[model samples]
Target: MTSQHAILTAEAHRDLTIRTERAAALGDAAMCCITVPDEFRAVQSEYPILFRLSDTRDRFTALAMFGFENGENLFLEDGRWDARYRPLAIEIQPFLIGGSPTDDGIGQVHIDLSSPRIDQGGQGERLFDTMGRPTPYLDRVAGLLGTLDQGYRAAPDFFAALQRHDLLEPFTLDVTLDDGSRNQLVGFHIIAEDRLATLDAGMLAELNAAGHLLPIYMAIASLEQFGELVGRRNRRIAHGRG
Candidate 1:
């Protein structure tokens, strides 16, 4: 579907409602989504945090992996996302931050008219109240968008720091399901534990003083979730759903 971006306003969207359920039709059945360092702690516990280079190959973005293959979200089941937390990027679907927030310290909200989450039948949360004022749900979405914007803006520096310290290394996951099917995931990166451990005191101090240390460790800790992720896939296969 073609995306129709429109500046969101209470006046225009007063009657529109958003379907909050997690479903593949609502664009939730994905293997991964863009994530930020600020959410590493929460995301680490649910998804495998990994890094990917942009299309231009000049920048890196953090990703919270939900499955090993495209269009396969292991955590999605029975109209719900089977996870305690969802990445902000995924949660803010159908809404995008428009305009330059950094210039004026404010952002314009744009909604995708083509998104399946848009409900005209008034079946979900209303975007605006009867008086055309922003509803509490809308307010929360705005705040989340603001956080997403800030985190997106701050991500490049964190990636650059990792590169500077040579802390990122290419990684691949080879998965063997219970049914004897094998899957290989590539084109991702992970924190180099060996390199990180061997970093000199000065380098460690630099990373710490710059506030990049915790997130770095968070990404490393997130690797443990990969085991659970594989287990989820195996379960799906066992249930004849894979």
Candidate 2:
């Protein structure tokens, strides 16, 4: 939950510093939610990008599958992420674009002051320079937050497209590690290839024109990464790292 949020202006946070270190503490099960339109290509190569219904089950959001279960992130070890590309959703941690306004504006950067990444002891990237201007790191974070905000706003339309086309379906994943332990991944949904194949030309054209086609295919391609996830899990178990 957000404990406090203020507009991230240089004046009020000139001395603030953000930890650039990898999130070793997030542990084995840090599943970060992602928006497909922006993060699909960035996430597809290294993570099994999947989808999950929102609490209301009214729409689905893409998820960068980090661990098999809560507190079990297979990609984290020795303070490093095992994959080459960490999803931006994971990269932008403890900081997010504000969803509501506080007399400033609706879309401004807000930092979770309680986040473990916040450090005033000067161990991380400084948010602003002596001139009270945003530092390069802060500038980069602002870009990330801006991209996230755009994706956040675009999410409803994307999901609405999926719902209109009836492309999503629930599927179960069962994996066996080297040690003979079985893991069944549940509650996740995927694009129904059959349904996608059966779409009429007019409907496909509509999805394509609305910029939903590529992301839909990207989600389909991401299913291949699930095999590689099993390999990572097997190695972790073999090396006593799981």
Candidate 3:
């Protein structure tokens, strides 16, 4: 594990508390929105992991859907929609399922982190194994992951840019879940600052110069919606159990 991962793990073990409520009363029309601390957001934004669809532009949508991080199953009026595509039949394991601890010894927001059965070569390999050839969508997602991998590989320079501006800071985040009950989570929350906003202008300028920004954002939006669909399905599975 990297230092960043270690830090998050230690934070996860802390006894912080978060506020939560049961989702039962929400009656399938509400989405759980937890207010994460700026620190956590910063860390999340900076972490090398491409957990967010926006970060990778949705290239890993299929992988993310199978793994369980962000999806629509978490919020849907009806829970009978079958995912359009199912990721490779790899074992599904629940990662971080629960609330995060707050800085003030409180637990907040529910978190669930899971890993998909991505093969040794990552999505590309899984795609080949599952379909014999990569479809356009699969190829797109693969390309997106590739781009993100490149960006993460170049994080040293990215960090340098932030350091040059003297804007580097330790991060902390608090999560809250509203399930008609209250829960608390606390620990060492870490995230990189909104260095993205600062970098976006430059990044966008470069992308615009290269004529590849608008298309990228559009792709990202599509993937984000797809991930939401998966989340909604998962949520239905959860509620159906009750």
Candidate 4:
């Protein structure tokens, strides 16, 4: 809903604060797609990492599953994240690194002007220092944005290889919480185990040469965490917090 995005400058954004609570800022999204390729390993241990096509249908995005349903992040409670690892996509919100519409090569930070979490008071880390220079917080944000931007460019090549190998498939997650409530998560995709197995050695070698196999396995391994998520949801409901 942000109508405008301005390039970040020290003078104009001296009063800005980047809120760390992303679940609220992102409307409590159930899935956070990974941007950087390196995120697969870290994300796999905690969340069920999945793959999905981009809105444009031109490429794919890796996602970290947080909850079974929309606006229901089971890992979030009392304004804190239960998991030690939060996806970089979740860590960076309300800010996007984009090119100028008029000149595609002119790249800069684009902030969501409509975000309620993007505030003017010193509620979180200050964007600028007293001397009108970017603070360490801003520097960190720059690094984070840079990583995601690079990831965006790299995802196509990585996912294209998986697509060529026909290793991706649709998935549905159905579970029952302890309170006798059932949850079904849909509209996500997972790596196909049988299809991956069917790949000939030459295709396997190609995937290995492209360095796409490990993340595939990592995503598959992360599916086990779905059980943990159900348990967390059940515990929350049990404690009357749901």
Ranking by TM-score: 1, 2, 4, 3
Per-residue accuracy of model 2 over 1-242 as CA lDDT, tens digit each: 34665667777778888776665553224655565566787788777777888889777888888767766677776777778987767777767887642234557788777676777747788988998888888888888877877777777788888888888999789887889999888998999999999999999999999888988888888889888888888888888886
Give the true-structure RMSD of model 1.
Answer: 1.3
lDDT to native, each model: 0.90, 0.78, 0.29, 0.76
Least accurate 10 contiguous residues by lDDT in model 3? 87-96
What would the C-alpha RMSD of candidate 2 be, to one decimal place?
2.5
Index of the highest-lDDT prediction: 1
In the range 130-150, model 1's lDDT, one tens digit per residue, is: 888888988999999999999
- Error in Å for residue 99 of model 1: 2.5
Clashing pairs in model 1?
none
lDDT of 4: 0.76
- lDDT value, candidate 3, whole model: 0.29
Q: How does model 4 score by TM-score?
A: 0.88
Evaluate residue 156 in candidate 4 and report its C-alpha lDDT on the 0 to 100 scale. 71
Model 1 residue-pair collision total: 0
Model 3: per-residue Cα lDDT over 184-228, one tens digit each: 222211113354345557765864564333323332243335334
Candidate 4 lDDT by residue in tens digits, 1-242: 63567777776877788777645554555545454556788888898887777678777777787877767788777677888887776666667787732443736887776766677865777788778888887788788887767666666777888788888898888887788889997767889999999988998888778777887788889999988988888888989976
Cα lDDT, model 1, residue 50: 91
